[model samples]
Target: MKNSTLLLAIASAMLLQAAPAVAQNNVPIRKIKAVRPTTELTLLDRVESDTHRKIYQYNEYGYITSVMEYNKEAEQWVLDTDNSYRQEYVFNAAGQCTARTSFNVDKAGNKTTEKNKAEVEVIGDKTWERYYKEYPDSTTHISEAFAYDKWGNCVEEILYGYDSYSKMETIRTYNKREYSGPVDKYTDNSNYESFKNGRLLYYLKARGFDDQITMNTNELFVEEFRKIVWQTENDKLYRREYGLDRGMDIQVGSIEKNMWKSSESEFTLNADGTRPVKETVRSYDETGEVKYDYTSHTYTWDDRGRLLASFEYNESPSEVSYKGEYTYADDYAKTLSLREAIAELSCGNQIYPEDEFLQFGRIATSSYYYAEDGDKGESTYEWNADGQLTGGKWSETCITSEPDTDNPTTRTDYGETRVGYNADGHMAWKIDHSITENEFIKIEYLYDKEGIWTGEAEYDGDSWDGPWTKEGERGNARARKRLATRAATTPKFIDDMTDGSHNIENNDGVWNTNGNYNVTDGVVTGGGYQQTLASNASVPANPQYNYTDPLMPLEGEEDEEVFTNEAEAVWSYTWNPQKGDWESEWSPTEAKRVYNKDGNIVADIYDGNQTIVSTITYRLDDDGRLIEEIYSKGGNITYEYLPGTDYLLESVETAADNSRNVCHYYYSKHNYVDPTGIESIKRNDVSTPVWYDLQGRRITTPTSKGIYIVNGKKVMVR
Candidate 1:
């Protein structure tokens, strides 16, 4: 059977397993470690290695106090002094972290006594945090303050950085919040207010200001300042505006820097003030005085409050427009409305009801872009019975105008992708086909018995049938062995551009050796120049050449010899002023070119030259692919390609002595996959344990209500 067919059959046999449902809990985990089994026979034979291990120490209140890391050295577990360091935290009786300290090793491999510490102070409805770091050569200090309203919503915040050398304190960021009504009022879940309130909550969360504590330490503060205004009518949010400012470097007691209004966004609700119907955004220049860009998006919804269509207009130095139409499966009635889903998620409720969720299958969308030359695209997705995406196809048509002409041309591009899952619900293989390029690639994943992804192999082919060659392999287990075998057997090639063919020709079209010729009906016409260089004995490095058209003789230069063809003008000549003639220059012996079975040049050897100054040898793989080249002078170049394809991965040029790299060039294609599973996880409904703080410090428990690292994701806990 063909490799592609066999792979597809195998993938098809692997039935997709449903993702294990998770239950919400508040259980605090004391310690956690990820270990791999030493043997493939049994998973129970797990071994702890120095590569990954961590120890946690916590206080009585479930808050972490300190952490120590160890590594296996000489078969003995010891502190990883070079990388492992202690981070300690101090908390008050109220379970709030009061201070934090971290240590690290210096360049000399010595653990420095110097440390960085952050202290926090909390008063009624207000908080302040100060951070100090001392290094061998420099010290840094930062301070932040926050104020909250009666509803426990932070209304103002300011951050400052101190420069000890200059004794200057610079304001880093500032933010202010205002609401037409109490912030708590937007949480009303009544049917009449659910839609508006849900949208308001979604918007607030997207802006990183939905919660009181999280708003104070928002990382966005480091990049820009914001002024948020929420307007409500009779407890219903009607509009919200966000104004952004940047370039905060004002010193304390000094005139404030001219803060540029970087961007602004305004959202307006529908007629009943139950859903957002329009959103407008504008961007300004660095000086904030000139408006450079503007975008407005208007949305329409069905009777059930499901998004139906959206239109967008953007003016960024030029005007462009976009439109998108959405279609849901007929069974969408079984699913919650968009507004209800958002509201439920905002209230920490599961967005999907187990059994009925999959009934809402496939969402087809069509989009259009309008500008100088308009284009349109359509995308359709397929979902399995379990709501897992099985395949998808996208096609677009674009219209472009010919250069310097009013004639317009239209081209269509299309692509399709298919995904298969293993019994563990992990993706097993994926096929991506670019119909426009007549190329397709497949990636098959390998996993251990426990369904842990160990490695993957990529294959490339022209069609969906028969031939499929492995192009790449990644991961540490089986892939490593395959790579070792390949290195031992595979030959290399040198992609020499001296021939002026191959990738450069295939990608950029026929070369225009000279601009004098015009191509029409595949026939070359017009005058062409043939130049020959002559090196002066005094200045060999500076050679001179002159362009001459064989058909057009020079007016005053009758002695100039004319050539009938370009090939005859290849040799250089010297001007003999004494004899008023041109003589052939002393030239090095010609190099003999050797070709391989594939008609590719394998070597170029100059036999007459005693030193063999320009000798080079080439090596190719079994499939006639070039992999390496050697120069007589000692310098060499090695090429790597995707395992089964002609696609070059990287090229390494070694110095003449082969001791160091002279140059390196890499060309690798990267495919981006959505982090969320096939069915978008718009909101995470499961609660996982928090093991670390935002600063990447291991924390047994969260000491404050802010953002914490949970399963490698930053989650905000209220």
Candidate 2:
């Protein structure tokens, strides 16, 4: 058929349909991209075995336009056909880049398509929209919609397709859910797995199962998702999936996860099902060649599913090559206890590596003393009641651990930390890390009355007090300790400020907030959160500045240990050379401030180069405690103040352009005014910070360590 004939046929079908309605899966999910706006970029015009050069092109809007694969052809730009793509986009009413679609185009411009459509809508101030798309179908296609929160983070994605041919217009659905409170520290592990149909696909075994498993993805593909039916001891879970790519076997897998919470925290799981415990894997083409593989192992548990051992397998023929097994007490089948587990594991020795006794003995842990023979001859370990691997030594010297179990009353001094179990089998304690050499750490965790770890905290009593670290980490003991520290110093800052408990005294001088930022004064400072402080120290260049004092603890104060608290910083300003009416308003003008006994501001002199630009005074009025702000421009006093509400009810401003701007503001639970009466514009967005250890290995907090030019590949610093 001619191209014109095909276009006519498509037009005819469209005309027959009449409305904007898509026919019953008439468009394959693949064609969705082509119908969108298409653009292209050419990367390597050609690559040469000896003189090949690389090129990269991007769309004007900063997106990838094209990447070309080429080979050397007389050392010139010659067409190479291997891998390339063309992208398409669509704009919504606002023209802010609503959608980005993609297609794989051959050198001839023939496009191989993927028929996925992302539906978007702005829920609030968030930029990224959620997503939804239907499964691909040449005849009957459906659509899915994605939903996002204010920060452009995906909240939920639902896969929806419709069977229009059915008399009842059947709707097929799958829903992926997300936690609403904060960013996912580990999405796959902490976020339960779900299918579009709302089925919980898989739950995590521990907080960081992905890190602990250390297996490759290819191996897991065959073991877990590849299995049809799976069983784990007496418990069982069922799952199912289908895809034509599975070849003749109709690749589908289902496994039963006998999920349960275990350990002091980090709910470690032990089971035997269709899923392999740990392994790396990769796939291959029809030719008998190595594709890629993940090293993986399947963990096994005792009769009651207590973690016993892990079985590792290789790729290709899929053969078991290594194993790490554990021994549990006979009573463990009924209940898992630390003492019983320790004794049972004590007898453990490596079953395989008969010649590599050293490798075998290492897995037993130090609680049950054993020796592993290696080049250095022997290695051993020791553990306190707390289960911390406190000792690791070679034949020459040893790092031994001594548990301060002297406190028989609580039997809680499991070394430096105090440990007691909640009804839910979770551990709680005050981890003391106050000692210098010992680094005595006290991790205290709080359980809801039901014994669920509700408040986890870590404390460094010397430098700071209260809670310094608190979060929900379910697996690693170290993580739990850190959480305890955070929980200890975790103040009710946000909660207290909401009620105006730490109301700014409305005094003089720049009211610097302590490291513990709980509330802001009444002044209209920019930078911090709350609706009013949009202009005060809101400049990111001075990110360390807050309207009120910060909550950083003095070093060594926790135990008289004078630590360098210099890492903590106060707000600083940079000089901008430009100045105008509006420009001066944007500038951090010089200001005088008077503080109350509690370090709260009582009165402030808003001075722009000692010109007495404004005066913000806090006082009691007939209605209630009120803040009065008087702006002095052109020798005229423009006053505005409200008794209760943090709003400017009077006139203001004397810019060079005479642009007398006046505005009012309000506050809510999620909003507030600073001590200077400035309403914060942006909220406290805690991104990953630049991390530094004693070794000075600096890693940016966001975990996006910029690419390190090492031998051409970017690897982690630690």
Candidate 3:
């Protein structure tokens, strides 16, 4: 997510001011402590996984002396020489970090040092920092400096180039007093301040781009934000006075005509400080007859502080309000306990005895868009006790009154979808049905013994009887996306039980029954199971589903699936520079896979540098079931699943690659037959007596309406 716009400096200034400033304390400064991971889970597609652990050697003063990688085969920690990485920290006599060096190391254990230094100065509450990086290439050298105020607030920054000319400078100013709470719910566009001392007031930046010089300034006012006023001014030197001809006066006039632009916004707030309920923004044009009127935006939120609806409108005659409403599977009313439920219904007025209300006991059951030529729609959802989404429906009536009598009086269409999950809680199958025609499509997902989705297939109807077959130029790509339309529209929203806040807010015992899908904290370490391909096929094992047409099809060739193996084969990926992530789609800097003697892909190295960025060594059991995966980065995860089921028995993780932290796996006796039975024991521990405020302070009692901590954990006590 790189910002290409030159005005990025203004956006960055806004971001810096949004965060509150931290107050400068007179106490001894706390040195940054080195962070070490106790557990890491290797991601499937990315080159770097959280499971890859980097161990650090710390000096007596708690500063990191060296960092090393885990060596799998040797079962030892080694210096990071593969990428030629080395770092060391230097401190002044006052114990303050003064300088740091990061260079490279060759395979022969020799250092390739470069001149990189960072100078720091501190006097009372003020500080200064200067950085210099001189690489072998002179053009690569970088010099930057920063100044802080008495409250440790950044006041200025400067950047210098190899030449005598200064590249850029940024200056910042602050408000006289820190803002106190009861903040306006509307018109408050200010950032969440980080400093307890003062709010940010202005940001001024000057930079040289190519041969042109430009200046930008942003000022902020902290006047309760009942009304917001925003302005932007830009000044530029078209050309140096030494080079400009007599026509320079005319160029200067043109620049002045478009020198600056300004805007203003006003807003109204809800009872809570979540966000503005309504806002209006207006822009000004100085040089043209075209005048811009105010554009307004409105929003609505649920009791839980989640946005439920929103809309926008403009003052133009042709413009109409566009609105949308979001509905969740579980609302605040449905998540209440039996006791609280009765109290809510009674509204604190005892209409009848509480016992009578609970006599037989128990149980139960649980958007709009607009224009004058109007389209109306409604959406509803279904879920199980565990808050796992099971089904949903959306219907819309485009034209309420048909223009022609021969056509249907009303044009109404509906889309209904149902989903099924595997034993491990991962999506297994989904059916999308067109209610009007009774036509439906089904997609089945295939996975290995570890429950990682490997392949997918789509059928024509609710049952696998109807298969979708295609013969075309992009047959392979189309086959991969047979169910693409359905997957693209699948709702990412989860039910209340899956919201993570449910357990903390509702103390009444209401257990989740959706199976062990997203829950990972209590996953006991241990075990290995044989990977097997089940003979069961969602679709018939007929001639249609297979792809035995050609080993490598010619360009623009047309071939159909004749008989492809049901088991998922190899995997491929591409890097998406725009997203800064590796994607399954093709990319320029993609990795190439090579097969080993065992016919397994052992390495995936980058094409440009041939660097072994990712390596996966598999250890198969007698039955050829993948029992272990050895990563080049030294971290390995072993899996064991229940027979014939995707449910895992145990997954043992190493603190680092081949670290001694590996522990023995054990199985405890249980009454329930499956892994879901362990949910009782996996519940979060809440035995200790502890309390905390909304600010995360350990307090004796609650003093505000926000979140609170009790029994050593967060729990909403309001």
Best by TM-score: 1
User: Per-residue lDDT tens digits of candidate 3, residues 1-718?
Assistant: 0111100001111111111111111111222222332322111110112223333333343333343343343654344564333556666665566656555556444557644555666766556676666543522354666666654445556665554246332322211211222111211222222212113333333333444332322222112111111222222101101111222222222333333334445445456433356555545454322345464667675665444565767585346566655545445333433223222322321112121112122111115556754666665556678645565666666655543455545577777667678887766666666677676666565554434344445445433344542111112333234434445533111122232222111101111011111212432121111111111112211111111112111111013243333332222333233543333432235343433336332434443332447766655445444456677777875654323322233345564535633322122222223221111111133344476665677765554434455655444331
Q: Write the per-residue lDDT of candidate 2 for residues 130-228, one digit (tens) a residue.
A: 333323243323344455444334444333334434412222332233332233322221112211112222321111122122112111222122111
Candidate 1 local accuracy as lDDT? 0.43
**Candidate 2: segments with Cα more than 4 A from true spot:** 1-288, 291-300, 311-416, 420-436, 444-458, 461-718
C-alpha lDDT of all candidate models, in order: 0.43, 0.30, 0.38
Ranked by lDDT, the better of candidates 1 and 3 is: 1
Rank candidates by TM-score, best first.
1, 3, 2
lDDT (Cα, 0-100) at 406 in candidate 1: 92
